[model samples]
Target: MADLTDRGTEVGPGEFAPWPLLTMHLGGHPLDQAQLQQLLAWELANPERAAAWGITPANGPGQLQERLDWLQALAPRHGDLPLPPAPLEQCLPLYWQLWLPLALTLKQARDELNRPLIQGVLGVQGTGKTTLTLILQHLLEGMGYRAVGLSIDDLYKTYRDRQQLVQADPRLRWRGPPGTHDIDLGLTTLAHIRTAAAGEAVALPRFDKSLHGGQGDRSDPEWVRDVDILLFEGWFLGARPIDPSGFDRAPAPILTEADRQFARDMNAQLATYLPLWDCLDRLMVLCPADYRLSKQWRKAAEHQMKALGKDGMSDAIIDEFVDYFWRALHPELFIDSLKRDGEHVDLVVEIDRDRIPRAIYSPALAMI
Candidate 1:
């Protein structure tokens, strides 16, 4: 597979080198630098900014600095994090500006709920859900919480099951979409974690995308114990179904009559995932500056894979792959709908073309 964290090159206005903020050879401030100073100034300039983001409410003066200091002390251990070649220094600005705040917010949510908090993160291709969960787990661990990351992919139907599914509906040529997951399995695992006692074993389902000729299948369940927080993320995580009629005049990709039917069926399938979404204590979206960028991001990922001398889909294949998902659940309709429904969504982090967060605000607050 390509570098999971690779957001590829430019997608919107302004050019960006592939992951400009990531570096393996780390040398720079871990914290308390220009980025930190700028963030502090931004927060100070407008106290309401924190409230709008739905993070832990800022307390008296210097509380934010105290939080930063606490996070800074834990930053060094992350300096050489090898996943996708990101360094602590290079990621410091994002940490101080976006991620650390999210960690703090998760901690606050955990404190409110006696049971384990299941936080759902929804992001499209290259929005950094994988990296975000890993970093958030680290920061939450620093804050004295046992946080674990789980992907919706893990809940996929066994290969044999999916084979049967494809036979029924040829439209599902791939694993992702709403109907492919074992919703019951997800509900069971979450329920087990929510009520698991200290030191009690909780097994999370794992899926291997490389298995069965890339058809993907369930592997052994990973045993973890006493998880205080679960960061559940996926491409369409937490997406809710829309009215079937919405597909009548659907956008570009859903142009054909067959395409509209597939979309409508997917909208119905989304209803099955609601019980799983109900399992979440909080939901946040890592939205793109433009949903269309996902196509470009997928192509970048494929290009990176080929550069590594690994087999990858051609640009034409990549287009078909991404467009299929968009047809199933277009960001314009489903994800944007989530952004509008503040009652369910807790936070929205708008990521720019460079995979940098440009805005972080609550949906209700954004309306204001």
Candidate 2:
């Protein structure tokens, strides 16, 4: 009844602008004459980007006219959407052109299997994992399927629980890194979602980082029922443990012998997360072109927070904050394995400095 990608934009029935579908391609899939004409018309409107996307313009006036005719019949869906200001196809070109197709492919696999699907997304901070999950849940629902969103951050242990971690290792004063999560809770939640019958309720967990003067704590639970697909995302959702020997080299500054040992300890902690990782039907990664970009992104976010009158981390503190996770298992080491040769990961969405999808790798597309 409503536009699922709503971004606060509202239009009366039969009075909306055409959606800009410029960057996506049909991907060599067979198309009927009408569909081919639609593709040609799209190529004509956005000639420069079209060439980059590997589309060729029609050679003759006859074919061009047919394409023009198709655009005349092409229509945009109009209604209220979840994402404010505009529909996803209008606001997120990369999501419309790239990620949407990947969602459909995952959906097709879900259908063929005839079972609940749990898709895990891994990305560094500011890589837009949450935004991607929201868009995906919206897209999946638009395709007549039910989807839910979960985050590994939500599976964090309570404030008192994390106090125990602090006692065990003072280096773990913060809530992130491997040792802080409640792996048992995550496992139970995933299994429940997988087998939940229609109308069965499942309580989804939430964590509030702003609580306890930023020490963070679990908030309340949100319940949902009958989800066909579960879109689980986090900075370290699908990461695996690396060789203990890899820790000896230390990718970043390991200030002290204790820090190095803590790094090794975190790597070992990754093994406990394997059961949770195994629940994923498909794993996707959002890999930045340069891992160093995360530092800049994190700084920008903190600056914005301070501008809004909220306390923000200083540059020195941000480095320690960011490095704490890297010390566990550098994304370059863990996510790269998933990108290059990871059998578990089903798709890799490579992003550039601007956080745009530069490329998508999947077995279907065969970038691997």
Candidate 3:
């Protein structure tokens, strides 16, 4: 119901090119019959993708066509949507397949829970967690729900506090690892967003990673009210601690007693942050087919920065940066634990090296 323009300025039709929905659904409406045929033809060419998303050859066509028709009608309500910050067109082919299910999941939860919901999105660096959240926010808004996003990075302790950490232990200089975030701040913010009165405002904290020469620090606050849903995303959002025995033989490159000790310490630190995870009604993990892809993605990001004529981390620095995360907490082990035992993790969207969403696994929903 809201206009796409900044400050809610009214923009007449044709003021900006209406960004057409490449896929069938635009919000929730479907496409026309001719467009539906085109979409079906595209899907037919990608049978492997159809199977991956649980679309069978028999019922998939009709089912998809129905959803496409719904999206066509829903498009005008959102007006011309803005393009994403990154070049994610490669993944657009699977957009509706993923987005529609997620939208339904949230709507179902909202109808059942009868209150605002806080959903946690877990993904390693460069897996497009923020992009997915932003997309969901747009889709949810078009569905008449007010959604807001909060990053775990925004909860990092103040610059002064992190400097104290450096004094305490120089290895703690980098901020992504456990023990760097202010868990209380995240907990309180979620609580406010989940329960704030209609007129009550909530000030969300923000961190400026570009400040202090990339050491990063908290910046100003962003205030919002009437958030029907909260998307709290971070690389290690729902990570759990591994057993102490699992640290016996530290992974390679970690070949040191001190490194093993640091791993244990970080694992212990994860427990202190569990109360924050308790706030999530559901958790969605964006998993890569290969965990090592993060290294390549991070490197590519640095190269992109260099192309922009900005200071960027060198190859060696990038290696250390990516390795620090593994040393802090191995994503494979933590994510596997959550997948097997986490009560909150309801969806897992597997991503391939090409950044396309290959499949979605929903264990809880399947049981239902």
Best TM-score goes to which candidate? 1
Error of 3 at 159 (Å): 0.8
Q: What's the TM for model 3?
A: 0.80
Ranked by lDDT from best down, the candidates are 1, 3, 2
Indicate whether candidate 1 or candidate 3 has the larger TM-score. Answer: 1
Number of the top lDDT candidate: 1
Clashing pairs in 1: none
Instruction: Compare candidates 1 and 2 on lDDT and give the better one.
Output: 1
Q: TM-score of predicted model 1?
A: 0.86
Indicate the TM-score of model 2: 0.77
Q: What is the per-residue lDDT of model 1 for residues 1-368, given as tens digits with 9 covering 90 to 100?
A: 11323233224766333222223112333433444454444564544446654434345235565665665567676754435566455555565557777887788789999779999999998777887888788778877999998999999999999999999988888999989999999999999999998899999999999988888789999999989999999999989989888899999789999999999999999899999999999999998889988888878877888999999899898888888998999888998899888888888888777777667778877677
lDDT of each: 0.78, 0.69, 0.73
lDDT of 3 at 153: 96
Window of ten residues with lowest summed lDDT in model 3? 1-10
The order of the candidates by TM-score, greatest first, is: 1, 3, 2
lDDT tens readout by residue for model 3, 1-368: 01112221223775421124453244444456666555566555655445434555576667675455435544454333344332223333444557654765676577788888888999998888887787778777877888889999999999999999879988896888889999999989988888889979999999999898777889989999888888899999988787888778766545688778888899999998899998889888887878888888888888989999998989899899888888888766677666555356777877777666666666454444
Worst 10 residues of 1 by lDDT: 17-26
Q: Candidate 1 regions off by >4 Å?
A: 1-41, 44-49, 53-60, 80-87
Off by over 4 Å in 3: 1-66, 74-92, 364-368
